[model samples]
Target: MRISLALLFAVVLQLPAENGYAQRTHVAISMNNVSVEQILNKIEETSDYVFFYNDKTIQKNRIVSVRNKSGKILDILDDIFKGTDITYTVVDKQIILSTNKMQLVQQEGQIQVKGVVKDAGGDPLIGVNVKVKDSTVGTITDINGNFSLQAKKGDVLEVSYVGYATKTVRVQNAQVLNIVLTEDTEVLNEVVVTALGIKKEAKSLSYNVQQVSNDEITRIADANFVNNLNGKVAGVTINSSSAGVGGSSRVVMRGTKSLNGNNNALYVVDGIPMSDMSAASTQPTDSYEGAGQSGDPISGLNPEDIESISVLSGPSAAALYGSAAANGVVMITTKKGREGRTSVSISNNTTFSAPLVLPEFQNTYGQTEVGSYYSWGSKLNTPSSYDPKDFFQTGVNVTNAASLSTGTDKNQTYLSLGTTNANGIIHNNDYERYNVTVRNVAKMLKDKLTLDLSFMLSSVKEQNMTSQGLYYNPLVPLYLFPAGDDFSKVQAYQRYDSERNLLTQYWPYSTSLALQNPYWITEHIKIPNHKNRYMATASAKYDFADWINVTARAKMDRNNERRERMYDAGTNTLFASKYGYYSKSNIENQQIYGELLLNINKYFVDNTLNLTANVGANFENNDYQSDYFGGKLKSVANLFTFGNVDTSEKNLANQYGYHLKKRAIFGSAQIGYKSMAYLDVTARNDWSSTFKGTNTGSFFYPSIGLSGIITDIFRCSTDIMPYMKVRVSYSEVGNSPDVFLAIPTYALVDGV
Candidate 1:
């Protein structure tokens, strides 16, 4: 008996310590306001263990707060489930979770749910997020705002949309749901994207900034989206050139600041500055002799790629951009991949356009004489059958775009492709464009280091682009055609010239040099423009501490543009030389920018006073080169190649090149008092290569602003007025001269 008792005691003593539980591993965790599922995920990630439990049996939605220093798994679980009626058991490499009162049993059935989301006004809300609460099953509303998901009964459905309040509806055995969301005006008015891609509370900003959402910018399509902003924003004016499709647009904010230089606002995309260069044009003494206006750089951007646009309309709001923002700044923010399940979206749009109004012409009078250009001739009993309306055709534009976004907790990816095909109001004039964009985001080192990389490729081709001059513009002859003339007679504008053995203009008039056969000009004269662009951006951010961080970003944007002008023989003699004229021009522009930023945010006085500061340095370089070959064609009558031009010194070609560099150091600081009042101060110093002398090359700018929330300070009812704030700012900004302005150069005379 004694020996048996001794054997039992020895075996019990030999068992594993901690009641047969093995000492697996220990972990250090500190989490606040986390969920039970998140805690288990962290544990699973840190150890070689898997968690097993019925999702329906576990209360994953319960909030948990825990802190442990090198604690064992069991001890951490105990701390996590201290007051809850839950328990866990570890066997082998799995942790089985069950309620304290009973064992967990997994459910095998799921309900299928379908729903349509709409706004309070009953308008379908596309892209609304519909998710089963606390699960990985989610979907977005399609173009028609309809969604479907597989969720069990009693599972909550969380629906959310931008600028709308979130709502959670419990599934009550209903197969279909029609949910309507209310607008959240406070959230819409509270956030604003500032200069340098910084987001801030609107009420705390010292200067005024206006925001335009993607919905507003994409509500209607235009060849030049910048024209859509006309009359939409205060203190801003937009002017679109008469050049047909893909024309240049001028945007002036506040007022003009430069007397001789460009007054157009600077454009920034995703925190990187973009070139706003426009193609050069010859100013004609009269409207009929100059080259057509070329498309602006901004016109090449796709509106579908934009997420939002913020207009810093005043110097105070654009102080950080230094000399480049003397006329204010237009900051563009693009969409990024979200942290959720994969989603794909596709959209198509078609637009029809026509002339809004046309000039009135006298049709009661015939030409003064048979072939005279004057319209003050004797009255005609039969009005002229010529109508200007017959010269213009209805324009059609079609655009298609698709985007895909997918991401995990630590990585995200986004890809987009779009195409635009459009026809102008004039015959034989059309434009086509293609664009592709890719972006990837990665988080490493426990989310302390973040990396973002993006690339964009775009191409634009314009056929028979209408120019301002009468040489290539069909409008010149279409509008000036004699009222008494039979318009259909000129439809076949080319006739065989027996002497030249070639097709020649069939016009009967010779008075005005600008007037020509419209059909002849449209078919014989060719002006084709092509532009290709590539942009790449890489940015990395490292959070060294909770209150301090640093970011380094670099970007390169390059584009090549080619334009050709060909004039066939027998065209207007004044516009084209003997045999014919052909000109080819190639322009290349490149911009490289790099920035390093230090950001700091700290709290004082028990979080009543919050302060934020940003110190950054930027380096930017721009290079532009243009090569032109222009002369009268030699030998070849219809060839449009540069090699066919006469190579003599009298018909020489010219080239031009310009290079500029800009460096800037900027700093900004903001202070807020209990989210009620705020003060902001910013300073920037720029060194421009365009300025020659040491002192003249550098400029300094500063801005200060103050804002106060009267409603918050006075304890007013928000129901009466959602928000009320007053702000005022003052700034001193400088404008740098145009490229090569400060340098001395001589033009080539006869190819000297």
Candidate 2:
């Protein structure tokens, strides 16, 4: 156990790959009956090479046939254009394609264009893509960020690099150019997503916050994306359920905070809180009965649609969210459209799962007597051949996902679809899910008013999710089977009883554990679950001025679930009668959230001081309902239905629901001095329906923090420490009492 935890921590602390492009990498291509344009795009997808060609000069419709495996780029290019007028030139990782016939016409106005690309910090950027706006004339920056290309005067130059914003400029008669590209804040490591999806500099924050990029989350795919976060974040613990694939995961930050209340961290998606719509967790009380796990609402979100995740492990970092974030917060930012060329990405991932370790079993021992449950017997000349591990099988998980992003400066859209089909190591344990998402952003009113809208749909089906308990768990009987018996005979786990005229369990052994054939438990006793959900969101922000703006947002999420458990005839008397047992439940949950914010930013004392503030009001309503019915069968031996429930026996019928509402007003202020130090303060007051009819229903919480840059305060050399800061904060948070704790309630007897 200690070794496992140490390994987990090691992975979380490792640094991510900072550089994406590698020079002189081998290329592989195999294609027949495809267009030249298709081949060019394929090369770009498989390697770091980008192809630039003029639509008029190159024959994009020409059919091409080529097969190369790990061959040099120059060799493959020579083979591809040997007999045609097409010519290719390789400059670093960029490929320029053109026809010899166009060179004669180009000499009329073509001139040598020379330029250097640098970052905002004056550092030269290598491998930056530089191209003419509408032609194939382009080249990549070589060592020292210098590039030379052929272009005419007045032609536009486009400069682009990963993690930096793209820039364009029109060339003049002068043949020299110097371009500086600024880093995109959205992709910067120093930028953090704060409460209400506000962007802030990490150095200015006074609390602990960790950001996990989308690449890191999807590095190791799982049915539930949360499982991929197990060893990726500091101060957070993620544990997958024992219920096999697509099961719920417990995510806790800073350890358990309450003895009776929920310790799980709150999940916020795109600035809206997501409700916990998972089934109630179950535990074996006396080893006679236990239930399987149901997937959580957060798992329904497609991982391919996520852009990033931020972890707020301390109360000071989540105080703006009021009582809901008392434990901690996990903020999920989804992908959105961007201004650029239309792009499509598709990926397929397959992974297998198996038991990491198994207990050693003795094959020399034999059962003391016939039909014995334990292998406490004398040694045998011929060792038993029974092996419990044979009951386990390799699990398979496959996921296919695709996404499309495109738009102009005025409007952008993003669409994605994903599907997962998986089976657990235990037989009859399986899970399948499908997801679709659409998002769009538009600018209107002279770029002052911005509108954003998104929608999502998800469907899931799961069966026989295995749990780590004695009851209904195949592992129990498989491991406890007596070695002396003929285990192969029990492979046929069911048989027709002549007297009862119905199928019955085949196992003849009986003991205190009430063990049945392992195969019978997996094939006969069953549990199935299904869920469908949809969410919609819309928001509008208008820039009244450069330093002030007002925004309004609203979202609705609805989920429906159906779960069932069925036991075949001749099962254990503790859970089922001679007839049979069946249980069914239907649950519906919904959450509606709306918010309005007033944002302000100003500079004071000739830019010596800066102040940023936000005042907001928000409301949320949650409605939940569930219906359940279950009982043992009456006269019909194998028929399982509500009408066939035995009237003389104690049956189960339940109907319960809850409606909770919360409203809050919040404000935050940040004051900065010369970009060196900052002071932050926030306050929120919440009114809850759980405490209705009492003044105590209203509660307030506030937090204050201060941070200062060490290098700036002491005037130390930045070369030794480019960024260093010390911070301290104090905060107070309130946890809303469980619903109905302050209200009167009654107990029901015999379903009255």
Candidate 3:
């Protein structure tokens, strides 16, 4: 019952202009009950001819059967459309279908044109688009980058490919042509945003800095935008947390630098440093628990409001920022109002996720006993139908956003609103977030003084976001369930208990491993987290001359978070008591930062030598507080209130806080000679409260870098090598000691 499928099509050949087609090409098809569109697609896939027609001209949805084993093209068409009013015409290599017969003959001056496309290195490029200028006639280059088409002598051919510039050339008397495309440098060469929101030319930078555009961040939607930067940059490693959806991501540049201190890159919004209050402190060397990790501060930002992100991957690039940026820096630039036409944008993004790789399991063996968890007994007569994948559901995320931007020459304004709702693969796991942002820029005092102001608010809520943890995780039990057992029996995971007079978990299996009914754990054990964040920023710049100006900026960012864990009655005694367990904590964090800077840009020696420098003073204050209280519920089932704690049993209550203040003065200068050689130097001194018990908690950092443009110095043509530079730098950066390391504090225990 083997039937060979044959491709019945014609080959590419030079034919006379008077002939409508070459010899009748025969094709063999053994399709059953397929649509006409399928047959057309097969023809196109197997032949040199392309079919062109409008949707209205063909009954693409009409179902028909064709059993042709060496039938001519015309004969097959006749049999497929015997009573239909369909007509077809064959142009040189294009087959046109229509209700009315239309004749499209080759022009008198038309001839076959052949060419090969290659890059600047003379290597052939495949999949390049080759088309006639302003015409629908087009074809893609083959494996050898060779293309052929019928065109007139005066017609133009457009050759294009991604990452390369488009090329248009007029066809002359030559029948054979060779086209070469060059890479577009304009898109690759962009201004680099460096430390403290300073702008500099890419060629003048001595250290590495990578910039990611807004489009790249929002192209694929994710609950946490940091996850989108996984594989986009070099020398950077991004590890996503096991904490299901909307979890924090760890970004490390270069490598881990600290042995017992923070190694995370500093996050700077606009020009101010923001605190990462939610980041986890435990590492691999410590007792790791994935469930304890939560979303970081950057996760609350709306991706649409971002203009670009710059990653300073070395210490030389962040020396001016002091000890906070010892590892590196991730600078975020928010979008601003542009003085142009008034516009409104609305967008919605929806995505679904599922596990692509799953572990293999042996289904031939059944458990030794009925209630045993292991499956290593006798061989099953029938293979087990139980699949761990059945316990997992498809994860979904939906995001809706809208924005309005309008402004005149003097003033501009931008406002945006966004909301996201997401569900994880595990049941009862959900995440929700909403964001609102408004920014305005104004020019006053005859355009000499400029002011910028912005405000943002975010609200987030999450429930039961399980990670790779044994406790309260349904996957642990689902994966180790006994094979050949009826999983459906556990679907009704709860039953009425007469003695306790309440609904109790209904599982007949051994509880030595702390295993519970998978369904019961998801429904009864709940963990919810909520966060609200607000931020406001204002900056004013006054220009005394075209080359010199002073700017002052201030920002305040605050966050309040509440987290709760509730265990219901009849839950595992290891994690819950008979009356159930409940715990909750509230945390508040705030940071206020302000800085004043003096910028100077001047040229000497007939504009051949240039100097750009900035001197600034910054002050930052941070305050953190936490309140926690929880205990076993008393005399009640599933009543998770703090007031219901059992007095006889041990209860927990605590309040702790810390305050940190810092002051720093920094200066950076870059000197350029003929825009070909540059020298950069930076110095910063910081005074912090963490240096208590010591003579002085102040330190100074300095860095110097030199870079030379090889191409510009030699005056070489840019075609062979567009850019070339040699750079070297040396820097001294330090990591400040943890707070309260020099002092000790005590807390009360049960009011003792």
Best by TM-score: 1
At residue 138, candidate 1 shows an lDDT of: 86
For residues 615-638, what per-residue lDDT tens digits would candidate 1 score against the true structure? 999999988888877877777788
Model 2 C-alpha lDDT per residue in residues 1-752, reported as the tens digit of each score: 00123322342344122111222466777778767766776777677776655555667768878787755665567667778898654444555566655442444555556678987645466556799998877776653577767677789999976567989988774335789999775654545688888766576688888888888778778998988887878899997877888887878898888887777788999888888653344332244554565556688889999988998988989999999999888899999876766889999989999988877777888887777777889888898888777888899999999999998878999999999999999888999999999999999986789999999999989998777778888887888788767888899888989998888889878757777788988888888988899999999999875568899999999998888888988887777889889878898999999999998866566345777799999999999998988878777876778887776766377887889999999999999876579999999999989888555868898999999988868888477675568999999996887777788789767757
RMSD of each: 10.5, 18.2, 22.3
Whole-model alpha-carbon lDDT for candidate 2: 0.79
Quick one: best lDDT, which candidate?
Answer: 2
Q: Per lDDT, what order, best first? A: 2, 3, 1
**What overall lDDT goes with each candidate model?**
0.77, 0.79, 0.78
Compare candidates 1 and 2 on TM-score and give the better one: 1
Cα distance off (Å), candidate 3, residue 256:
2.0
* Order of quality (TM-score): 1, 2, 3
Candidate 2 stretches greater than 4 Å from native? 1-188, 278-288, 360-386, 482-486, 693-695, 717-721
Measured with C-alpha atoms, the lDDT of residue 213 in candidate 1 is 78
Better of 1 and 3 by TM-score: 1
Q: Which window of 10 residues has the lowest lDDT sum in candidate 3?
A: 1-10
